[model samples]
Target: MRTSSSALFGLGLVMAVDRLVFQPDRPISDVQQTLLGIVRRVART
Candidate 1:
């Protein structure tokens, strides 16, 4: 069995978002926060 790069990237993205949301106490740097905001906006559309 083989997974495409896009599939792996999507899996990693889901995992990262899961960690960030479920672990609020984990401090995120300003850059990361900005990126997250961008991602959220893009996701909405």
Candidate 2:
């Protein structure tokens, strides 16, 4: 099977975050929202 770079990056980020911080029992969608918020905040500066 094959996967795009973004998919791989997301998987790596999830694993790294789970290991380094609290394991999120919430849906993955929440993380997507948080990431989007961060990007938007950066862009406004």
Candidate 3:
């Protein structure tokens, strides 16, 4: 249960960072884009 909660917290944190830092006008590195894509896929599932 604790692990699950921590995982959820981490996901939420990632999502928050995605929205705050990855704006349309801003450019991101390839690694950052890949990480964001992975996070988005996981979020959809």
Model 3 lDDT, residue 26, Cα: 46
Model 3 TM-score?
0.49
Of the pair 1 and 3, which is ahead by lDDT? Answer: 3
RMSD of each: 8.3, 6.8, 6.7
lDDT of 1 by residue, 1-45 (tens): 145456546755865786678866665564367556766775676
Candidate 2 has which clashing residue pairs, if any?
Answer: none
Model 3 residue pairs with clashes: none
Q: State TM-scores per candidate.
A: 0.43, 0.50, 0.49
List, residue by residue over 1-45, the lDDT tens digit for candidate 2: 145456556765875587457855756677667666765675576
Q: Identify the leading candidate in terms of lDDT.
A: 3
Q: Which stretches of candidate 2 lie over 4 Å from their true place?
A: 1-16, 19-21
Writing each residue's lDDT as its tens digit, candidate 3 over 1-45 gives 687568767866775577567764544464467656776776687
How many clashes does each candidate structure show, in the order listed? 0, 0, 0
